[model samples]
Each structure stands twice: as structure tokens, then as C-alpha cells.
Target: MRTSGVLPDAFTCSFLLKACVSLLDIANGKILHGVVEKLGFGSNLFLQNMILNLYGLCGEMADAMLLFDKMPQRDVVTWNTVITQMLKRGDIEGASRLFSRLEEESGLRPNQVTVVSVLAACADLCALDLGKRVHEYSNRSGFKNNVLVCNTLIDMYAKCGSLEEASRVFDEMEGKRTVFSWSAMIVGLAAHGRAQEALSLFSSMLQDGTEPNGVTFVGLLHACAHMGLVDEGRAFFTSMTRDYGITPGIEHYGCMVDLLSRAGLVKEAYEFIMEMPIKPNGIIWGALLGGCRLHKDIKLAEQAIQHLSVLDPLNDGYYIVLSNIYAEAGRWEDVTRVRKLMKARGVKKTSGWSKITLDDGIVHEFVAGDESHPQAEGIFRKWDELVVEMMLRGYVANTSLVLLDIEEEQKVKFIYRHSEKLAVSFGLLNTPAGTTIRIIKNLRVCEDCHSALKLIAAISGREIVVRDRNRFHCFKDGCCSCGDYW
Candidate 1:
């Protein structure tokens, strides 16, 4: 059109920019941005908002900010564009700073879109104070009755570790709670170990005529798994389709595998996987493999390895899990062979790590070979102290769970390298005396690490909550809240 001497208007330019965003053509998007500037439509609020949106969609925060800064007269949409963009890019700090600046300098009041975006940032950062402030802002701005804003507030509070506040927001919602609202509460309750409440809320969701979607079922399944309600889990698994006409997806199947496996029904879990309507994915096989490790079912563990290797040939966790299974079975030769295969395939196991929030509200993370922190030496020394204290509290590290072909001493070294232990040790050093340590891991917490954590919790007189890939384990006084079933 430009070449034909028919210059595009602001609306035309905005449409083209949206098209570029949809196609994810950042190069073409920049070209369009230049065209908008040349056409003198760059200052148009609508066109500028489109540019902001395009930059955000492309994850080009710097470009978006530059555009935002150049805009002379900004509207709520303009601020929402930049704030939402920052949130999506995981720049919570940038989003918060901009929000503060908008209120202080721009004098532009935030709308529902702005509130949603800011709430999302708060949730991602786990910034409880910021979230509460947003909550107050929403209330003062009369957005407290907005269902979308209320739902987001519920989610923000829940994710930030304030279930009571989440419940309060949930209860005060005058509007009909949507499925998402129910999901947020269910997830929050399940995550915080309020499994029964989660399940009850799920039932209430259905009774209130809100049809439970796949996510709702997933949350219910998770609650059932946490409570060891295998019968309820299985019933829900079937009811998902039979009663609700919702087909069971990979997530549903994954939850079922977790539920059965955690109940020590390893063989049944394996059989269920074989019978899945869809071919079992890596997550399903991984769950069964995890169950095999927990129950020490070497024969089934070997069977699980065959499925896992074929399903996820490139994932190193399968190889590591299989090797461990062989080690647990006392098959050193098999372990050696598995190691050789891993070497030949160039499969490197993923390093495990954990994160903990200190008393000062700073999150410290640790992984194997982590040396970037300023107090690395002090952290290691604290680790040593915890090791001694743990042993004094009758904590015997379960080296047998290492599933290595190495001697006992080597196995002990491997256990110490676990991500949970590193995070716990760091927590001990950074937190105040008697402060509970909450660590979240991306993988399953090894049995040895679990036992050691219990001992550490007792010796230090601090509660410890560890959220692994599968479930939550709350440790206090040398015992886990899960009753060792997980």
C-alpha cells in the first residue's frame, strides 16, 4: 500500500501490527513500527498501544519500554499494555516499578486490565506485600466486586502463601464464581496440604452447576492423591468422561498414576498405564518409575524402563531412574551396562536444585556446583553443621536408595549432592533461628533426602515444607506430615 502511494492510517497500522504479533514476526513488526513513525501515526494512542502490545508479545521489553516512554498522552490501555507485557516477560520488578511510577507521576488510575496484569506479577514473584497492596487498591477503586479482579486476587493470595486471605476473597465474591475461581481455591488448598477442603470445594463447584473442566478434575485428583484417597481418585478418573463427558487427557492419567503409585500399588499403576486410552507419555511412565523406586519393585522397575526409554528416549531422567532401579535390585552388572548406554547416548542427567525463602524474604537457591553466591563458603560450612546435627538426632542417611553400583561411601556423597539437601542447608544458614524452611524442588525428593530432612527439622527445631514434583512433605519433630506414605 505504501509503495502504491496509499499510506496506511492508524487503524490499518494497528491491524498490521497485530497481524505481525500473531505471526510472531518480530522483524516485520519492527519494519511496521518504522512505517508508523514515518506516517506520523506513531503518536496515535491506538497505534502506540498496538506497538506496545507487539513488543510485549515478542518479549522485547526494551523496545516496548522505549515506545512507552515516547508516548506523550497515555491512557489506561497504554499502561496496561506495558505492565501486562512486563508481567508476561517475567520481569516482575519492572512491572511493579512502572505501576508505582504510573500512580505517582502519570496520575493515571489503573483499570481491571491493569489490576489483572499487576496481580499476575505479584503471583509470579510471590510478593505477598505487593499483592495485598494491589488488593487494597482494587477495593478502594471499587474493583473489589469485579469477578475477574476478585478471582485474580484469590489466586495471587493463594500463590503467595496466604490461604486464609484467598478464602476471604473467595467468600466475599458476590458474583458467581467461575470454574477458574474454583480451580484456584482447589489448587491452593491442595498445595497447602488442605486436601480435604480442596476435595470439598470441588464437590461444591459441581453442586453449584459449574461444570468441572479438565483443570478442576486435575485439582481434585491432586487432592485425592495427597490424601491417599485411591478409591476417590479412581472414581473421579472414570467419572471425568463417563459422568461429565470429558475425555481423560495426559494430565488426568498422570494424576491417576501418581495416586496409585503413592499408595504402593505399583503393579496396578503399571497395568493402568498399559490400559490408558492414549499411549502413555513420559510423565505417566515417569510416575510409575517413581513408584517403582519407592516400593523397590525392581522387576516392575525394569519393565517401566522399557516404556520410559521408548517414550522419552532423550530424557536423562529415565536412564538415571533405570540405573537406580538396577542398583536397588543389587544388579551391579546391569547398572554398569545402563551407565555405559547413557555414556554412549551422551545423556547427561539434569542437576537437581531447590529454593528457599529466608526470614528477610530473600529467596536463595542452590544447585550442584553452585558457586555464584557471595557466601558460598559459609553455606557449605552450615551444611556440615547440619550433617553433624542430623546424625546426632538419629538420622541415618539411607544410602541404599542411591541405586548406584558404587561403594557405601560413594553413595553417601551422591545423597549429599541432592538438590533438597543443598536448599535446606542454605535455608539453615540464611534463616533466623527456629524459622521454618520451605523448599520447592523441580523433581522428586529422594528417599534419603526425605529422611535426612526429617532429622534436620527435628534437630533444628524448625518446621520444613518441601514441595517436590509429586507432593508436599511437611517435616517437624523427626516425622513427615505425609506419614511416610509419599
Candidate 2:
């Protein structure tokens, strides 16, 4: 049209922008944006929003924010577009700050979309206090009864270590429950090690005439894995095809391998992987390797690592695990070789860290042996006190898997200063005696830390909830909710 000297109108630009968004053609979209400006169509709000949508969908947040700041007039769609894109790029904190700006600056009440997205961010960060504030706002704005918002509320509460609140939300959505609602609740319960409750709820879901989907079964399999119910896991896996006609996806298959592996069925899990109709992925082999680690089957671990090196060569955890397995068997030569290979491939092991959210809604993070916080002095002092009490209560440090050639005393000190312990120590020092301490860890909790936390919870007269990479461990009265399975 430009070459023919026939000027394109706003509607033509709008349709072409929509096509660009659909095709994800950002280069053409940029040229069209310049053409729109050159044609004096840039001031059109509809056209501007379309261009913003184009930038956001194509993962060009820099351009989106630039345009967003320049627009003199905006709408809720503009804010939601930017917020959603921020989340897609894994900027949970940024999305949250934008939501706050939306409220403080725009004078625009958040709609259901904004509420749901913000609630998801709250869940990811385990920001329970902020989530509660949002829940209160949702109630005042009459969004509490919206099914999607309610579903997200359930998920947020569960992930934030408030199962009672999650259950309350689930019950409140009684007549309005959908498959997603049921699945979210079941998955939440399973994650918290409430396997019996999850299974019972599934039966009730069936009685209520809700058909189970793949997600629902995934929850069931996870519940079984936590409880070490291998037979029940097999039954559920078979029923997915026989009764529900739901073909298993990679997630379902992964859950099955995890279930069998955690139950000490490493050999059976390996056979199951080989017989799979679909090709096994890294998660499948990783599950088998984790099982081998648990059961101390070095031969099977070596076999699994061969496949893992080809499938997921850059995952530092696999190499680290293989090294640890060799260390366990007193094979220092092989451990050194694995370490050399990791160095050669530029694979660095991920350092473990733990974070806790306080009542003030700020997250405090601690790394292993971290003493950088202002309260570092008090935190270590608190740990010293807990150590005395824990040793008196029969808490022996299990340093069998330290994997270091250092002195035994050094190894003991190393495990004692694990990140989760420091985070929990901080929580105990700050909170009252009876308050529950919730912690989130970046990696799986070590055996020594897990045992120590159990005793510490009993001695401190508090409930300690630790969300690790694999699952949650609720410690109270010298016992764990996982029953020592996970």
C-alpha cells in the first residue's frame, strides 16, 4: 500500500498487528509499528495496545515497557499484558511490583485476571502474608466467589504451607468445584504428605461425578509415592488406561518411576523404563538413579549415569550424585574422575540455599555456612543452643554421606551449618515458641539435616515445615509426616 501510494488506515494496521502477534513475527511487527507512526496512526489507543500485545507475546519486554511508559492513556489490558509477560519471563518479583504500581498509580481496581496472576506469583514465592492481603482485597472487591480466583487461592495457600487455609478455601468452593479445583486440592494434599486424605478425596471426587484427568492421577501417584504404596501406584497407573482411557504422558510416567524408585524397586523401575512405549527422558533415568542412591546399588547407578550423560550432560546434579554414590562405596578414584569430568564440561554443582518469609512479608535467604545477615550472630548462637538440646534428645549427626575427605570434626561442623538449619534457627529466634516455621530449600534436604530438624522441632516445641526440591517434610514431636519414606 505504501509503494502504491495508497495510505493504510488504523483498521488495516490493527489487523496486520494481530496477524504479527499470531505468527510471532516481531521483525515485521517492528516495521509495521514504524509505518503506523509515519502514517500518524500511532496515537490510536487500540493500535498502541495491539503493538504492546505484539511485543509482550514475542518476549520483548524491553520494548513493551518502553512503549508502556510512553503511552499517555492506558487501560487495565495494558497493565495485565505487562504483568503477564513479566511472569512468563520468570520475573515473579517484577510482576508483583507492577501489580502494586497498578493499584497505587492507576486508580484501577484489579480484575479477575490480575488477581489470578498476582496470586500465582504469591504462590511461587510462598508469600503467605501477601497472599492473605490479596484474599482480603478479593473479598472486598467481590472476586472471592469467582471460581478461577478461588482455585488459585487454594493453590496459593497450599504452596505457602497453610494446608488448613487451603482446605477451607476448597470447602468454601463446594458446589462450585471443577476438575481443576479437585486436582489442585488433591495435588496440594499429596505434596504436604497427606496421602490418605488425597486418596479419600479422590474417591469423593468420583462420587461427585467428576472424571479424573491426567493431572488428577498424577496427584494420586504422588500420594502413593510419598506413602511408599507401590502396589497402589501400580493399580492407579494401570487404571489410567483401563478405566479412565487417559493415556499416560511423560509426567505420569515420571511419577511412576519416582514411586517405584522411592519404594526401593530400582530394578523393577529400570525394567519398567525399558518396556515403556515412549522413549524415556532424563527425568526417567534420573528417577532410577535416585532410587539407586537410596538403595546403595552402585552397579545400577553406574548404568543409569551412562544414559544420563548422553541425555542430560549438563545437569550438575547427576554428576554430583554419581560422585556421591562412588564416595559412599569408598571408590575415591571414580569420584575424582567424575569431578574432573564435571570440570571439563563446565558443570558446576548448585549450591543449596533456604529462604523463609516472615510476617513482615519479606523473604530472608541463607546459604550453607552463610554469616552475612545482620542477625548472623544471633542465628549461630541460637543454633549452638539448639545443638546442646538436640544432642541431649538423642540427635546424632549422620555424616556418612558428607563425601568430603576432611576431618570428621570438620565434616560435623559442615553439616551443622546447612542452610535449612540456619533458616530455621532464624525463624525460631524471631517467632514465638508455638508458631510454625516454614522454610523453602533449593535442593533436596540432606539426611543429617532432616534428622536434626526432627529433634529440633521436638525440643523447641514447634512445628517445622520444610519444602525441599522433591517434597515437603512436616516435623513435629520427633516425627516426620512422610514417615521417613521420602
Candidate 3:
């Protein structure tokens, strides 16, 4: 048609752009962008939105935003397209800000798609306040009964450290609940270490005539692993194949290894891996190594490391865990050797960071010894005050995991500055006395921080909820939800 000098109309360009989006053909999309502009169809809202969709779907957010900014008008689809893309790329805060703009400035109420996307961002950031506002909006808009929105609400509430709310949402869904509703609640309960409750829910799910799927088993296996119910976990694993007719995937296998490993069946877990039909991945070996670390199985840890070094060479956490294990065993020479190996391989430890969402619906982040926040001085001062109370409450910092050859006091100081500690102190200073403090961490919370938080919660008379790399730890009255098993 171009060779015959037949000019493409807005509909023709829209059809071609839709095809580009379907095929993820960004190259052709760019060429068509020029064609649309050259053909004087640039002002056509339908064709322009299609081009934006092509850019967003193809991972060209820069171009999408460029086109979006230049558009004089945008409908709900336009905002949803950009916001969903932001989510796919893990830009939770960006998506949240865009949702804010949509609410405050766009003069348009968000549609169902926009609400789901914003709820996802809220869940990821643990922005409970913003999530609650969105939930209210859903109710006002009559979207509360919508299954997809309700499912997302369950997930959001659970991750935000409000299991009570999550359960309420699940119960309300009742006849409307899908398999995902059950699975999401199960997984959330498992992550919170309410394994028995999670399993009981699965029983109810089965009784309700909901057929279990692979995801359901993953949640069940996770529950069993966390509860240290080896026999029960094994039964569930076998039942997946025998009863449910579901072929266990890598995640299932990983959960099994975690269960055996956590149960101190290191050798059995190893043998289990050797006998697997599919090849084990780094997560499989990493689970074994974590068990070794817990049980101090040095020999097995070394073997796991051998496979880990090849499978995930650049992963610094593995090297660090190995070194810590060596340090725990008082094998200074082995620790030194591991450090040397890491240096030789140019692997650096991943920096741990923590983020906390305040009532204002903004997420604030911190690193170990972070002084970047505007209230850094107040945060540090509050921590100093908490240290006095914590010490009075018998909070002696456990420096056993601190590998550095330093004085005991120096080790304690090092422990004091971990990212979670900073985030908790910030929460204490910023929130009211009785408000619960919620924190999300990028790495496992160190033992020292865990112990300190228990005492902090006791002394502050506040509940502190922490979600780390593995699971949730809710501290209240000088006790953690995991019973220190994690």
C-alpha cells in the first residue's frame, strides 16, 4: 500500500500498532510512529494510544512516557498502560506516584484496571494506609465484589502485616473465591509462620470443592517446611503426585529440600536432590546450604558450596553465608580462605536495605548506618534512646555472627547499625506511641536485629512487623511469631 502511495488512515495505523504490540515488534512500532506522524494522524487519540501501548508493552517506557506527555488527552487505558508497565519493571513507587496523579490531577476516577495496578504497587511496598484508601474506593465504586480486585485486596492486606484483614477479605469472598484466593491466603499464612492455620485452610479449600493446583501445593509445602513437620511435609509432597496428579516443579522440589534441610535431614535432602528427575538449580543447593548453616553441617555446607559456586557464581550471599558458617565453627583459616576466594572472584557482598511506609503513604528506605534521610539526626538520636531502654530490658547484642576480628563493644556497635534497626528506629520516632511499625527488608534479618527488635517491642509497647528475604517476623511482648525457629 505504501509503494502504491496509498496513505494509511488512523484506523490502519491503529491496526498495525496493535499487531506491533501483539508481536512485541518495537522496531516496526518505531517506524510506524514516524508514519503516523508523517501522515498527520498524530492527533488521533485512538491511534496515539495504540502507539503508547506498543511502547509500554514492548518495554520502551521512555518512548511511552514521551508519547504520553505529548498527548493532550488520555483516557483510563492510557494511565493503566503506563502504570502496569511500571509495575512489570518493578517500579512500585513510580506506579504509586502515577496513581496519585491519576487521582489528584487527572480529574478522572480510576477504573478497575487502574485500581488493581495500584493495589499491586501498594502490596509490594507494604503501603497499608494507601492500600486501605484504595480498598475504601473499591467499596464505594462497587468493585468490592469483583473477584480479581478482592483477591488483590487479600494479598495486599496480608503482605502489609494485617492477616486479620486478609482473612476477613477471604471470608467475605466465600462463594466468589477462586483457586487463587485460597492459594494466596495459604501462601500468606505460611509466610507469616501460621503453618497449622494454612494447612487447615487448605483442608477447607478441598472441602469447598475447589480443585488444588500446582500453586496450592507450593503453599502447602511452604507451610510444612516452616512448621518443621517433616513427616507431614513428605506426605504432602507424595500426595501432590498421587492424589492431585500434579507434577512437582522446581519450586516444589526447593520447598521439599528446605523442609528436609530445616529438619536437620541434610544427608537425606542431599540424596533427595541426587535422585531428582530434573536437574536441581541454585535455589535447591542454596536451600541445602541454609540448612547446613542452621545445623552447622560443615561438610555438607562445603559440598553445597561446590555446586553453588558453579551454578550461581556471582551470588555474594552464598559466599557470605559460607564465611559466616566457618566463622561460627571458629575455623579462622577457612574463613580467611573463603574471603580470599571471594576477592579473587571479584564478588562483593550485596548491600542490605530496608524500606518502611509511613502513614503519609510514602516509602522511606535505609541501609546499614544510613544517614541519608532528612530526619537522619532524629533517627539516630531515637536509636540511641532505644539502646538505653533495650539494655535496661536485658537486650545484650549477640555478636556471634559478626565475623570481623574486633572488640566485643565494636561488634555490638556494628550490629546496632543494621538496616532493620535503622528502619525500626525511624518508625518509632515518626509514628505515634502505640502504632505498629512495619518494615520490609531486602536480606534476612540478622539474629542480633531480631533479638533487639523483641526487646524494642517490649520496651516501646508497640508491635513491630518485619518482612525479610524469607518471611515475616512479628514482635510483641518480647516474643517473635516464628518462635525463633526461623
Candidate 4:
């Protein structure tokens, strides 16, 4: 319109800015901001809100906030935009505070979009209490029936370690079920080690004449992987392409490798990777490497590292995993070589951390060997007691995972300082019996922690649900839901 000698108005600029946001065209977006100012629509609330949203979506939060502060008038959309962007950037506290202000200060009732965004924040933080409150409000306000809101509710519940509630929401939404609904519910069930139930739900979805999408197959494959149903996983992967004609993406390939590798078919996984129509990406190679680490397949792990070094040269995870395999195999020299390579390349390993959700609606984070919490001394004391109790129960600390060239006794002490154990110890100290302890890990759970957790469950008689870097493991009655396979 401007090129045609017609002066663009606020509406035109808003539409253009939205297009730029959708396209993530930061370069053009800045020029459009200038155009808005030149058109003298800087004070146009709608256009200004759109500009704020554009900056937010482009990850220019500082710019967005600067503009937000200068605006003389702010509407519900403006608040929603800023809050939603905050959540998208993983700023749960910021989003939650803004969400509270929406009703308390502005007296603006949150719409489905705002509620969905808040629910997402709650999910990421694993703030189940907050999520429950949001669910209650959605039901009271009749927004639970909204498709987007309902779908997000299921995801939030699942991600917060409440799979049953997610399933209830899905089962009750019979008429409102969409493809996204089925996909979300399936992934949730599959993640919780409910492979059979997830498959049953998939069958039910098909019976209801709902066609499967790529995401649906991803869920099915995931269920198979965790269940060690290699034949079933193979059949599903075949059907996904041969029956549904949906081309398998890297995610599907990664799942297939995980299924084969986790089941101890490391050689087959490598063969499958080589046969992939598309070049195997880092995920596929990493999946293979992870399998090698699980099964101690040094040869395949070395091969995986060869490809991974070329595919993801800067990723320290692959190198660390290879070192782990070497250590497990008792090849100390190889472990040293891998560590040397990592140091030479300046590849810093990602530090492991765990998060525990407290009953008082707070999430506490503990890094490996962390002593930052106010109750750190008490937590450590509890952990020490648990260690002694576990030792009396015939638990021997598996120090093979401690890669350092140190004394065996020191390695055992090092194992005790793992973040997950610290979090669980803190949970046991504070929480009442029979309450489940949920932990989120930033890296794959070490073998030592996995064995130690199994014993912890047996001794404490409390169920522990840990969503590790790889998959979810629920330990109870001296066993894990993955049956020692994962």
C-alpha cells in the first residue's frame, strides 16, 4: 500500500508485523517498527501491542519490555502477550506474577490463551498444585471444553507427572477429541511406562476413525521402545510409512534406534542407522551411542563416536557417553583418551541437576554435590543415613560410573553426592510417607543412581518417579517400571 502511494494505517502495520513475527523475520521486523513510527501510529494501542508481541516472539524480551513500559494504555491483549512470551522463554515466575496481576490489578479475566500459557509454565516447573488450581478455574469458567485449553491441560497434567488426570481429561472429552488431543494423550501414556495402555488408546483412536499423524506414531514407537517390544516397534514403524504413507522423520528413526539399542540389539541398531533413507543425524547416532553405553558395546560405541564427532563435533554428551562405555568396559586407557580429547576440544560436559517439587508449591533444584539450599546440612545428614541403611541392606555402591582416576572409597562417596539422591533424600526428610517423590534430571541417570534408587524405594517404601534425560522411570517395591532395562 505504501509503494502504491497509499499511507498504511495501524491495521496494515499490525498485519505486517504479525506476518514478520510468524516468519521470525527479525531483520524486516525492525524495519516495520520504523514504518509504524513513521506512520505516526506509535500511540495506536493495537499496533503497539502487535509490535510488543513481535519483539517478544523474536526473543527480544528486553525490547518488548521497554516498549511495554512506555505505552500509556495497556489492554488485556497486551498483558496476555507479555505473559505468554515470558512463559515461552521459560520465565515461569515472571509469567505467574503477571498472570496473578491480570485478575488482581487489571480485573481482566484470563481467556483460554492466557490460561493455556500459564498451564504450560506450571508444567515446566512441575507445580502440580498451581496446575490443579488452573484446571479448577478452567472448569468453573467453562474453558476446559475449549480444544486448545483442553489439549494444553492434558499436556500440563502429563508433564507434571499426573498421567491419570491427563487420561481422565482425554477420556471425558469424547466429542471434542482432535488429532492433537489423541497425540498428546498417547505421548503422555507412553512416557509414563504405560505402553499397553497407550497402544490400547491408539487402537481406540483408530476405532473411533481418528487417523494417526506423525506424532501419533512417535508415541507408539516410544511405547515400544520402553516396553522392549522390538517386534511391535518394527511393525509400527513399517505401518507408519507403508500404511499411512507418512515419511519417517529423524525423531522416528531415533526412536527405532532406541528401541533396538535399548533392547541390546546394538548391532541391529547400527545396521538400521546405515539403512536410513535420510542421513542419520546426531539424534540417531546418539541413540545408538546411548544403547552402546547401556549394553557396553565398545565397538559400536566407537563407531557411533566416529559419526557423532563429524555430525555434532561440539556436543560433549557424545564424548562423555563414549567415556562412560569405556569405563564400564574397564578400558581405563580408552576412558583417559576420550577425556583428553574432550579437554583438548574444550568440550565442557553439561552438569547434571535435579528438581524436586515441594508440597508448598516450590520447586527446589539440586546440582551434583550442591550445598546451596538452606537445609543442606539436614539433607546431607538424611542422605548419609540412607546410605548406611542401604549398605546394611546389602547395597554396594557401583563406583564404575565414577570416571575419575581416584580411590575406590572416594568413588563411592562421589556416588552419594549425585543430584537425584540428594533430592530424594530431601524429599524423604520433609514429605510424609506414601507421598510420591518426583525428580527431573538434566542428564541421563547413571547406572549407579538407577541401582541406588531401586534400593531406596525398597528401603523407604516410597514410590519415586524420575524423569531422567532419556525416559521416565518409576521405582516402587524394589523395582523400576522399566524392569532394569532402561
Q: Residue by residue across 142-261, what tens digits does model 3's lDDT show?
A: 998999999999999988889999999999998999999999999999989899999999999999999999998998998889889899899999999999899999999999999999
C-alpha RMSD values across all candidates? 3.6, 3.2, 3.0, 3.2
> For candidate 4, lDDT tens digit of each residue in 1-486?
667898887778888888998899888988998898887888889888888888899899999989988887888789989987886675656666776777887777888876887788777766676678778878987886788988988988888778879989887899889989999999988887889989999999999999999999999999999889999999999999898999999999999999999999999999998899999999999999989988888888999999988989989999988887887778889889988899998898889999887766556889998988899999999988888988888888887678888999899878889999999999998899999898889887888899889989999999998988767788998898777767
lDDT of 2 by residue, 123-181 (tens): 88777776787788899999978999999999999888898999999999989999999
What TM-scores do the predictions have? Answer: 0.83, 0.89, 0.90, 0.89
Error of 4 at 462 (Å): 3.1
In TM-score terms, candidate 2 sits at: 0.89
Query: 382, model 3: CA deviation in Å?
Result: 1.3
lDDT of each: 0.80, 0.89, 0.90, 0.86
Q: After superposition, which runs of candidate 2 have C-alpha atoms over 4 Å from their true positions?
A: 1-69, 82-101
Ranking by lDDT: 3, 2, 4, 1
Q: How far out, in Å, is residue 466 in model 3?
A: 0.8
Tens-place lDDT per residue, model 1, 223-327, is 888778998888888898999999888999999998898789998998888888898888898888888877888888788778877878878887887787777
Provide the global lDDT of candidate 1 against the true structure: 0.80
- How far out, in Å, is residue 383 in model 1? 2.8
How does candidate 4 score on lDDT? Answer: 0.86
Candidate 3: worst-modelled 10 consecutive residues by lDDT? 87-96
